[model samples]
Target: MQKIVDTAKGLEGLKRQWGVHAAGVILSRDPLVDVLPIHKREQDGAIITQWDMGACESIGLLKMDFLGLRNLTILDDCLDAIRENRGEDVVLEQLPLDDKPTYELLARGDTLGVFQFDGGPMRALLRSMIPDNFEDISAVGALYRPGPMGANAHNEYADRKNNRKPVVPIHPELAESLADILGDTYGLIVYQEQVMAIAQKVAGYTLGKADLLRRAMGKKKKEILDKEFQPFSAGMKEQGYTDAAIKTLWDILVPFSDYAFNKAHSAAYGVVSYWTAYLKANYPAEYMSGLLTSVGDDKDKSAVYLAECRRMGIKVLPPDVNESMARFAAVGQDIRFGLAAVRNVGTNVVEAIRRCRKEKGAYTDFYDFLRKVDAVACNKKTIESLIKAGAFDSMGHPRKGLLAIHADAIDSFLDIKRNEAVGQYDLFGDAFGGGDDAVGAGMVVTPQIPAGEWDKGDLLTFEREMLGLYVSDHPLFGVEHVLTAAADMTIGALAEESSVGDGAVVTLAGILSGVQRRITKQGRAWASATLEDLGGAVEVLFFPNTYEIVGQYIAEDAIVVVKGRVDRRDDQPRLMAMDMSLPDITAADEVKPVVLALPRPGARRRWSSGCARC
Candidate 1:
């Protein structure tokens, strides 16, 4: 142990290895080697330094962090979609700063697709803030963080913004310097840049030195703070400020500076938030199309956004071979689910299909499509996938009919094209060439479609199979409100707050997407069911006792309430079922009342096995 301690002590604080900083970058006017110890990153072979970012900064170098944002891509896609659909370039700069509809949308907390303000806590803050303009929006971006939001700064912000509390000045003498800048935020220093601005205004510090002052305050270094205070106090005294006023101002700066955000970054995010709100307010279909595309690969995320689309009265069509593209797109006012999102649908195939659609018009029914396209690219498997995704519904037939035809129709269509390759030769010289004449005339009769319509359960099942989500309808669509009330939380909400400690009690509602039975070590039967609704999906473990007590309640496509303690044994959280009941039915009305195996107050026994989320 003593030898190991000595080795670790030698290793500690030493640059034992080099690693890339995700956001940190070092800048210097001179050659990097002259300024700091430099090297090539072994992993990527990029030029890097052995010195840490802070070390580089301390030695007269600039280090800037670049925040990677997925929303920026989403916003760009939304704007491009808007322009394509609306035929107007929506000038972002020309937008009204105090747009009423935008603020109204924000205040109502309908920020599912909005940037920076879509999270649960942020939305809750928005509801109380009831922001009327851009300033409040900017303040929201700055305050909704672990520091300010945790400190309940949002409450004070809301109170001041809503006129519930008066905007208190930092100091009567410095009010003029502070008023214009801090007026909107109720004089609370919510931004780091505000500290600099406040120092410049109240303490008469130059912008550069004021920035240094902010840096010192953020680091809370006594030596730097002591040096910064001299010029700050002296400058305030030179500006005819009394010592008492300066002391009061400096006292406020110390604590608030720790959590204060950078106004520039916050305002940038705030502008993005407004842009998202604007898109949602006016071009909802386009906005949702972008949102859906952004999360197309994630079924859970796609489901949440799709639900939001439905709530916005936008119809989401399943992947259509005729209209669907490689990415989610808005057709008129409805969002078409992308073919790329379809399970087993390859990107190459999607590209091929989209390229073909762009080259010619939409496919001329199933057989015309079958005959014209590359048979190798869009093979039987691809056709089957398209059918399952309801992509062939636009061909004047049900998906089942398309399925029936693909087995024979593709061959017959190919045969016509094959026969045309020989130019309809009948032992004559004139017919001995591959001609457009024969190829153009090659047409097969449309095969008879099945008379019966595919069952709704089967159709939705197919859509779910292909899209990883129900496109036409979900099992618990209309009863969302009832389910919401019955369950302690929705599947989506549960997913967001899944970091809660294990054995935490929670109730959630969703259709039984899947159910798998197993035999325990004790030879007792148990089941694990996937409870999924519009919001999201969660796994529920029903042990032998719970399974036997309410086994009938657990069936596929049935909207059931799951009451259980959170089993966060896995990376993903799952609910160990203690209770299960259908929506609109009272718990007492259930066949067998809920008998949860909650750990007794003085006991140490555990209930169920670990679960896998669906």
Candidate 2:
């Protein structure tokens, strides 16, 4: 036992391995090779320093972080889209900070894709705070973390900002001195900058010394804190503050410094949050087009955004080979889905299709499309995927008919190309002649199959399979009334933290998707699935007990009504399903009373006599 303890202690602080920081870089005026050793990472062949950030800083080499944020890219894409579609240039930096519509959108908790303000808890806080200016946005961003949230600082800020609670000072004697520093945060020490400001203002510490004190408090450096305590109290006393006020001010700063965010960082994020909100409120379709293109490869995120689009009264049309670009585009009051977002479609094929469309005219029909598209890029799988995703719907042919003849069309085109490659004569020999004019004339004889359209369920299933979502229609289309009548609330409504309390019982109905069945350690079956309705989707969990009764009904594409309790254990709410059932629109068991009108006073007596005789 003693040897094991000594061995563990010896290994505790030893250098185990070498790794690189994700975004940190060391900047120096001198040559890097002359000052320190460097090497390239094996994965991407990027140069990295031999020492860590702290070592570089200790050696007086300046270290900086260059963060790459996807939201920033989304903002750029949105602005570019606005220019292309609307012919109007939008500069994000020049946007008005006091935009009324932006604040209204934020206050309504409509920030599904807004940066830094999309989470459920953050949205709830925004609704409560009703932020009217940029400062409130910055303060909300700083106060949303674990430290401030744990201390109920977020709720207190909301209440005080909304005039429901009073903004009390840390100490009466120091209130006037600290008011200017803490005024924006409603007398709460929400930022590390505020702590430094307080130290400089009330305790008469120099800027450099106050910054040191802020760092010491944030890192909880006991030695430095103890060393600085005497001077801080003495400075306050010299400023005519009493001992009690000094102690009270110190008490609040100690714990808050642990998680107080930097004001500059929070304000920067607030700028981005406001930009997204502004664009979404004023230019929804254009902004959503860029937003969708940004996350085009992520199916779940695309679905969430599509639901938001629906809520905003913007129609998202399915991918059309004649209309879609490589990325999602915004039409007038609508968004056209991008072809690159299709499951089996590749970028090469998308580029080929676009190039062909731009050079030649629009595809007259499915046959014309096969003839015009690049044979090498648009192969069997690509054509089939495009067909199934409803990309050919605008060519005036049903997806079912296109699916029926797409294989033969591809094979025939390939055969003709093969014959041409071998220097053989044309197969049709001027009957179906070459050149763009002949091709236009040959459209009359294009092959047409007499296949019927698929049912709504099968059509939507194919769309979902190919496009990763049901674009044209959903499975719960006709039965919405039944689901609404059975469900206690929509899945979207349940997503709001204030709409339903944790562990509160509620009923919901939607089509089950992404169902996963698993077995527990005790060999009992459990399952999880995403219940998606018109508004949105929610995760539903079935434990062993509930699974016994509901497992049979839980399957992919099954429309179900789930009775469950809200599970708010995670950032998003989930459903702990207690019972489940299939929606039954045919079931009518209600006993509604029938009323019959009597024309005369004796009509009731005559009807009764007639009923008795019968």
TM-score of each: 0.82, 0.84
Best by lDDT: 2
Give per-candidate clash totals: 1, 0
Question: In candidate 1, what are the lDDT values of residues 117-230, reduced to their tens digit?
Answer: 777767777888888788888888888775675557778899887677987777788777788878767877789877888778766778998887887887778897787788
Per-residue lDDT tens digits of candidate 2, residues 1-614? 99999999999998899987788889999999998889988899998988888888888999888999888888888888788888999988799999989988888888989998877778888888888999999999999987788778999999998788999988888778888988878888898888888888888989999988877877777887787789999999999999999899887887787888898999988888889999999999988998998887766668778888987899999999898988888888899999988978888888888889889888877877777777665488888888889998887778888888877767767665555556664545566566433332443344666568888878888899998888887777667778888999888778777788999999999899889999999999999999988777889999999999878888999988999989999988999999999878554334233446443222457888988999
Instruction: Supply the global lDDT for candidate 1.
Output: 0.77
Instruction: For candidate 1, give the lDDT of residue 203.
Output: 67
Pairs of residues clashing in candidate 2: none
- Model 2: lDDT equals 0.84
TM-score between candidate 2 and the true structure: 0.84
